[model samples]
Target chain A: MYERTIDDTVTTFGVSGKLWRDSMIMYDRATESLWSHITGECFRGAHEGAKLAVVPSTQTTWAEWRTHHPGSRILFKPGGKGEGSHYRRYFDDPARFGIHGRGIDDDRLAGKDLVLGVRFGDDRVAYPIAAFGDASVRNDSIAGVPVVLIYMKESEAVHVYERTADEKTVHFEPVIAENGLLMRDRETGSLWNPARGEGIEGPRAGNRLERIPATKIFWFAWQTFYPRSRIGGID
Target chain B: MTGTAVLFTLLLQASAPFERSQEVLMGDTLYSVLPLDAIPAIDEPQFVPVAVADTFLAPTEMIIGVSIDGDDRAYSAWQLDEHEIVNDVVGGVPIAVTW
Candidate 1:
C-alpha cells in the first residue's frame, strides 16, 4: 500500500478572468452580497487563518446538502458552460453515492489504492483518493469520453493504471523516479496525459502540463483571495 | 411622513460624525452580516492592522479566539506582535478578527 498521508484540505479560488458575483444583490464590496451561482457541498471558512471546513458530498438533494455545507464553493471546468445543476456529479453526497448507477469495479483493483490529482483552471486543483475493493480500471474511452484510472498494488507501485481521455487510449506504469510520482506508457514508452493522450516525458510525463505539487497548488489558490475580512457593516 | 423624516434628520445631525477606520485582522468569524450602516465601502487591498486582545480575543493552538459577550456582542484584541496565521499569498479582502 502507498503509505502516505495526503493533505486532503484544499482551498480553490476563482481564476482572475472568472467573474465572482452574488445573485442576492448588485455587485458591491461594501454590501458583501451572496453568490449567485456557487454550488457544490463543501465547507468554507472566513477567517484569515480559519481552517475551512471541507464538506464531503452527502447523497441528498442540493438544498439539503447546502443546509449542511453552506460555505462550500463549486468548481467548474475551465471555459465550461456555467451550468448550476448536476453539481451532485462532482460533489459527494452520501445518499446519492450508489444511486448514480455507477458501481465500483472492485475485481480489477484487487489489492491496490489509486491516488489521483486533478488540475483545473489556473489555480484550482484537487486530489481525491478512493480505494477499490478488487477492481481494475481499463484504458479505454467510456462512451467516447476520456477518463483515467488509478489502481493501487500490494507490492507494485501505485500508478496511473490507465489513461482514456480525449478519445485516446494509453496505458501507464507508475515508477519511483526522483522520489516523485511518474507515469510511463506500458507499450510505446511515450509520455501520456493521465486524462487523454501521452504526455511529453515518461519519467515525469505530466509534470509540465499537469501533475502539479499539491502543496504549491494550495498555496497559490490561498494567496489569490484577500484574507477573510470581518467588515463590521456595509454602508 | 414629513414629521418622521424631520425626526430622523434631527437624530442624524445630533450624532457624532462617523469616521471610518480600516484594519486587516486574522480571524475566522463570519462578520459579513453586520448591518450595512455600520460599515461602508472599504478600499480593496488595504493593509489594515490585525490585533487581538486578552478578554476580547484569545489565541489558542493555531486558532485565534474572538469572544461573544453576554449581550450578544462581538469584540476582539490584537496581539502586539505580528504573527501570520495564514500566508499572505491570498490577497483578496482579508478581514478576519478573533478575540
Candidate 2:
C-alpha cells in the first residue's frame, strides 16, 4: 500500500478529449503500465502497447488536454469482435495508479508537464521518460510489489529495487563518453572501458566484450545477494 | 558408594545458590533458540517457546533460523507492525498467527 501525490495531466500519443481522471488526487502507485482485458487496444493503465507518459503540470482546467492532442480521436464505444475494435474497451479502464473519477478540482497538476525530446541531437537516441514499476516488483513473480520502473533521457525502462538482493537484476545503461568512461559504482567513480582493459566481472565475465569508447555507452548489470541466476536465465 | 557420595556432594555444591529459588524454578523451563550445535545462527527475534504456560498456548516465537527454500528468509510471525507482509505468497506453510 504505497501512497503517491499525483498532480500532472498525463498526455499520451493516442488519447484525446477531456481528461476524465483529475491529476490532483493522491493515488496508490500500483500497476505501472495500463492493462486491459481486451487484447490489442491499450489505455493509460498497465497494459501492453501502453507506455508511461508524463502529466502536464500547468493548466486551469481539465479541458486543456484537448488543446494538447488537437487531432487525436477517442473511441468511447465498447470493444468489437477483434482487431482495432478492442481499443474501445479501454475507454473506462482506470489509470494504472488507481487515479480515476472527475469533478475533483486539483491544483497540483496546474503546471506540471513532461518534456519529450531527442537527446544529444541524435534521432536514434530515444530517452525512456516513463515506466510504471521499479526494480523491486520487476524481478518478483508476484503480480505487484511496489514496482519501481524508471526511464532516463536516453535509455529503456528500468525496475527500481528496494534493497539490493540475491538474483535481482540491477539494470542500468551506463553511458561512457570520449575522454570519459562510464563507472560501475557511481559513488566511487569507477570507469568501465574495454580499450583500457577494464575487465568485466560478476556474471558476464567472459561474454562478448565491447570497447567502451569515449562516446555514448550503455551497460547493464544485475545485483544479487546470492549469485544463483547466471547468464542466459536461471536453469 | 564413595563415587555416589562424591557425586551427591558435587550436586549439593552446584545447587547451593539456586536452592532458595528452586521453588520458583519448577515453573521455569529453559528454551534453546537453535538446535544443540547449529552454526551461523541468527541473533534476531531473541525469543523462543520451550514450554507452554497453558495447554491452549500456541507457539508464538517460531522463526526460521535459515532458508527452507534454497535461499529465502522469512519469519512465521507476520511482523505486521513493521508492515512488510503485503505482497508475499507462501503456498503450504503453517500459520501460527496472522496479523
Candidate 3:
C-alpha cells in the first residue's frame, strides 16, 4: 500500500501491464511515469525519481478481518463476479518464483517458502511460515531489540511487536487456550492477545507491546530484493 | 497466504505477461511490453458493509485490510487479481491499494 500523492498533487494509478524484476509496474495518470509496485519507486517518466509513501496495512482472511473489524467495509466490483484469484495455478507451483523462475543465487530457503518479513531500520528478518503450525508465536530479536512474532493460523497473518514494555523486555511462548491461541510472557506470566498486542492477564495486565509492521513475502523475492536479509528459524 | 500477496508473489515469480525486451534500471529487470492500462485500475471503488460482503466473499478468501484513524476498508484479493490496483481514500489519505 502507498500514498498516491506525488509532489503535493494527488494522482491516480493503473497497472501498466509491465514488469520490473517480474513485479507489477504501476503508472500514474498525472505523469504516466512507471513505478515499481514492489518498492514504490518511480522508474520511468516525469516522476522518475519520486516514490510513494509506504502505508502500513494488514493482509488476512475475510473471516479473520471481519471478526476483528466487524463493521469494516469491503471493495466490490459491480456488474462482475464476486471474488476469486486468477493465479491459483502459479501460486501452487512451488518451482516457479516469477516470470523467470527463482534465479536468485541464494539457497537459504526454497524459492516458494512463504515468510513473514519484518523490517527494522535498514535490516530485515524472515520467519518461514511453514516452520510454525497453524497458530503459533515466536520470540526473536531484531538488531538486538527484543521482539515477538505471532502467526494467525486462520488468516496466516503475521503480527510483529517490540517486546519491551516500560523499558523492560519480555519473551513469549504460545499457549493453546480454549478460546483460541494466545501468548504468555515468560517473565510476568502475562497472557497476551496477539492481535491487540496487549497483555491480557497476570502482572503485565494492561501493558501493550509496540506494533511492528510486517509483510508476508516469498523467500525468493525477499532474497532477490534484499540480499542482506537474514533468515529466521535457521538455527 | 492472503490473496493479494499470493497474486503479488505470483506476479513476481510467474511467467511474464508479455514478451520480454531488454531494459535495466535500478538493478531490476524491466519490461514495458504491454501498453498502459492493460489491466485497468479501479479508480472509483464501490464498497459495501460486511453484512453485504459476507454474501459473496468466501470465509477463507484473502483480502487486504486497511484501517486508519478508525476508518477501515478491505480490498478483495480476487478483485485485485483482475484489476491489480485500486485508488481510494482511507482515513482522509489518498492511497493506492496495489497488488
Candidate 4:
C-alpha cells in the first residue's frame, strides 16, 4: 500500500505494536519512528515529519486476481504460519468499531461500513460499498479532474480512472451488454472494460484510461484519518 | 505549509465529535498495544505459483493485487490479517503491503 523507499533509500518496517485510532502503527527499523499503516505518515520518533508514498493497489476476489494475473506470485506465510486470522471475529461483527468501544462520531454512515476512498491533490472522496449495489459505473470529478468509478459487485472490486483520452474529457455510461462489456463513452461510443480501463471495440480501441489510486477501507478508519473527506454515491 | 493549512481547515470542518488535535498525534495519541514486532511482518516473503495457490486460496476470499512495472503479486487478506505487513521489492520498487 506504500512505497518503502525514502530519500533514495529503502526502509524496512515492523509492527510497532502501537495503535493510532485503533489502527496498526508500523515502525521503520532504520529510524524507529512509528508510522500509520493507513496514512503512511510518521506520527512519532526520529522521522516525525516524514511520510511514505502510496502505491496503488486493487482489492478483489482471489479468483478474479488469479484470472487477471495467472503468473502473479502469491505471498504465503512460511510453513503454514498464516493459516488463521486474528481479526476474523472482528470482521464478522458489523457493530464493532475498533480496539476500544468508541462509537462513530460522524453519523453519515455506520462505523464499520466499507468504502472505496480516492484521494489526490487536495481532493478526497469516500464511496460507500453499499452504493455499488450490484455492478455500477459512474462518472464524477475530484478537485475538478474528471474520473469514473467502476464497482464489480461479485468480485468485490472497485477501480477509478481518469476518463480523459487524447486531450479530451469524455462522459461514460455503464454498459449492460450480455457479453460482459462494462462502459460506453458518450463522445465516441467506445465500449470499455472497467477492470482494465481499455477501450474494447470502438473508435478508441486500444486506448486505456489512466488509473487513479484508490483504497477499500472501513468507514471509521477512513474518517478517522481523513476527517474532512467528502461522502458521495451513498444512499 | 500549504498541506498543513489545508489540514487545519479540514480538521476544523471535521464532523466527528472527537477533537483531532495534530499536536496530540505527536504526543499521547498513540496507544502502545504490544511489544515491538508483536505481530511480525513477513520479511523475506516466499511466493507460490497460481496452481499452488488455488489449492489453498478460496475463490471468494479477497486478495490485494498489485502490478507495478510488469511484476504482479497477490496477497491474500487472510494472511495479511495475521502478519499485517509484507515488505517486498516489486519491479525494483520497494513496497510494504499492509492490511
Name the best candidate (by lDDT).
3
| Candidate order, lDDT descending | 3, 4, 1, 2
**In model 2, which regions exceed 4 Å deviation?**
A1-104, A111-149, A154-158, A166-235, B1-99
Candidate 1 error regions (>4 Å): A1-128, A132-141, A144-146, A150-168, A192-198, A202-235, B1-85, B88-99
Q: Over the stretch B10-96, how does candidate 1's per-residue lDDT look in tens digits? A: 222333321121122222112222233231211221121222112221222111211112111111111100111111112131222
Can you write out model 2's per-residue Cα lDDT over A52-148, one digit (the tens) per residue?
2221111111133223333322211122122232211212222211011122122211111121111111111111222212221112111222111
Per-model TM-score versus the true fold:
0.23, 0.17, 0.58, 0.56
lDDT of 1 at A185: 61
Report the TM-score of the second chain of model 1 against its true counterpart.
0.16
Each candidate's iRMS in angstroms? 21.7, 31.6, 4.4, 7.8
After TM-score superposition, what is the CA distance of residue B37 in candidate 3 from its true location, in Å? 1.2
Candidate 3 collision pairs: A97-B13, A98-B12, A98-B13, A98-B14, A99-B14
For candidate 3, the lDDT comes to: 0.76
TM-score of candidate 4 to 2 decimals: 0.56
Candidate 4, residue A110: Cα displacement in angstroms equals 9.1
- Each candidate: RMSD: 21.6, 29.1, 9.1, 9.7
- lDDT: which is higher, 1 or 3? 3
lDDT of 3 by residue, A1-235 (tens): 8899999999999877665544567889998898877667787899887878977778778899999998898997777653233343344466765543447568889876888887777668888888877548888788788888888774455688999977988878888888667899888788999877988999988988898767667787777767888888722
Winner of 1 and 2 under DockQ: 1
Clash counts for the predictions, in order:
61, 41, 5, 0
Q: Candidate 2 docking category?
A: incorrect
